[model samples]
Target chain A: MNSIHDMGGMHGFGRVEREVNEPVFHAPWEGRVMALYRALGFLQFWTIDGGRAAIESLPPQTYLTASYYARWLMGLERSLARSGIVGADEIAAGRSLRPARSHPHIMTASDVANLQRGNFERPTASPARFKPGERVRTLNLNPETHTRLPRYARDKEGLVEAVHGCHVFPDTAAIGAGENPQWLYTVVFTGRQLWGADADPTLSVSIEAFEPYLAPV
Target chain B: MGDDHKHDHEHPDHSQLGEMQARVRALESILTEKGYVDRSTLDLIVDTYETKVGPRNGARIVARSWTDPEFKARLLSDATAAANSLGFPNPVGAHLIAVENTPQTHNLVVCTLCSCYPWEVLGLPPVWYKSAPYRSRAVIEPRAVLAEFGVELPENTRIRVWDSTAETRFLVLPMRPPGTEGWSEQRLADLVTRDSMIGAGLVRGP
Candidate 1:
């Protein structure tokens, strides 16, 4: 879905501010929110892609105004309610009203010690259609469902810098379709190609695009 | 309004912070009540990131790459295996790619669609990294963005912005600064800041 979160090349955001000696998190709650997000993942409540989709699906206004972890909190609530793990009324009441739903796994101290980062790579279904140094063009796509292709790079031509093997396609994974792994490539585009005549010539952009999002130029 | 007088003038975000605190606490309680989450597990997760893992891990890798050409070659060719050889495995199925910065070229990393970072190496991303300004402009006007970060490059040097839109994560291997000959890897590692690895800033000379 085309949302404010796909903020590549669009302007009007103010100057970047760097906080000196910034802590890992600002507040205690922020750490808890981060932990909750990871813990939820440990329990296999939702795929990482699904969590990202939930955050992207937020209304543009809320999406823009919410802080980083605040967005996480909102997405968690949305995912939980959507999956029927917790009811909307229960969230509103600030407590669980129904009996606990049995889950195949629950996060424990041992699980926390053994937590590992999710690997989306899968066995390739077929050989890669494109190769390094090959010219390719990104397909212009705007699906209502989850997609990794940013709006700015749509329909742009690029050179394949590297073929990153097969990985889970988020478009299918986010909607519960399946892993649907595709050949992923690192495609490089000149700044002029992406941003037009005013772009600085020294700039180049490379995006990791799945094969489904690209075609022969 | 009666409550207006109670507002803390110095800390304007006090109320908003309270609201956020309540919301997160409520959600944790709900999850715990449903037996989905353990409070101890949450504490452990937070503690792990807070103290155990961070950019020091990446700094060590960068410093080693600076001193050891073979390790650098392996890191460039197969970053995942190289990092794992040093006990720094990337999260599950994700691949790690190390883009080196040369005198004629530079590398920057961003996630335009969402905040995808090499957490196992560089830890969680900074606030500006996930902000709209950096994500929106880094690809189009990288020189200007680097200028804001005090990294003014020569006009002839090329800038490459890597938008991590897939499962692959990037780490910018900043060029080693000069005048630090015979320096120990520990000393070099101390000079490797997190910002330099993200391509937002350059490593300064000793």
Candidate 2:
């Protein structure tokens, strides 16, 4: 989805403020929210991609107005509601109305180590469709759903620098779709290519792109 | 660096307990009461990133790379192994890639979709890194963004913006300062700022 979260190029948000000696979290609640978010991710309630999709699902006004952890909180609620772990009413009501349903895949403290070593890389039967140095153009698509392809790079031509091994496709996996592992590539584009001739000519940008989003130019 | 001096800031002291904070506390209390989340475990998770793991881990790696040529070679080639060799464990979904800043080119990292940082090394991301302005402007006008951060490069230097779109996370091996040739690793590590590793600032001279 071409949501506001994909704010790659559009401007006028004002100056970037830096906090001196910033802590891991701003507020105590922020930490708790983060911990809960991580806990949800650990339980595999939703893929990281799906979580991102949930955040992007926020309406423009809410997205711009909410704090960082607020987005995380909202996204977590969206995923939990979609997964039937808890509903919006229960969330606002501050307690479960009925007995909790059992989930087989609960993650506990003992599983933290195993979770750390887990890898997202998966094997693929099909060979890569693109190689290094091949010129390609990003497929321009604006689906109203989860996607990893950024809006700025869509339809822009770039050179494949390297073909990363097959990995789970996030666009589909985010929404309860299968892993759908596909070829990933590091594509390099001049800033001019992505922006315009007025952009810094010497500047270049590289992005990791899924095979489905690219085509040989 | 001048910009930083001009932008005199205090530590992120979130002292004022706003309505948002109250709501968050309420949510936490509810989740804890529900048995869905354990408060102690939650604190442990947060503490791991807040105190135990953070930019200091990345600073150690950056310091080593600056002093050791072989480690630098290994880091630029295969960052994961190089990092693990220095006791930097791989985070669950991270694949580290070190992009060195050279005389002619500069590198910066941003996740346009989400704040996908190398948590094992750099800990949780800063607030601005995840904000809309940084995410949008970092790719579009990196020079201006860097300027706002007080990082000014020569006109001829080209900026290479790396958008972390997938699992492959990147860390910028900022150039070793000119006068720090014989500095010890610990001394060098002290000079390594979090923003330098993120390509938003330079290592200050001793």
Write candidate 1's Cα lDDT for A35-139 as tens digits.
999988776767889999999999998887777888888999999998888888998999999987779777777776656677778898899999999999999
Predicted complexes: DockQ each: 0.52, 0.47
lDDT of 2 by residue, B1-206 (tens): 22242232212224434655766676666656655676777877777767767888899889999888999999888887888887643343446789999999999999988898887778788888887778989998999999999999999999999999998888999989988878999999999988999999988786
> Which parts of model 2 have CA positions greater than 4 angstroms off?
A110-118, B1-18, B88-93
- What does candidate 1's lDDT look like per residue over B1-206, in tens digits? 11122122112387888988887899899989889888998998899788867899889889999999999999999887777778743332248899999999999999998899888888888888888788888987888889899999999999999999988989999999998789999999999999999998899997
> For candidate 2, what is the total of clashing residue pairs?
0
lDDT of 1 at B9: 18
Off by over 4 Å in 1: B1-12, B88-93
Give candidate 2's whole-model lDDT: 0.81
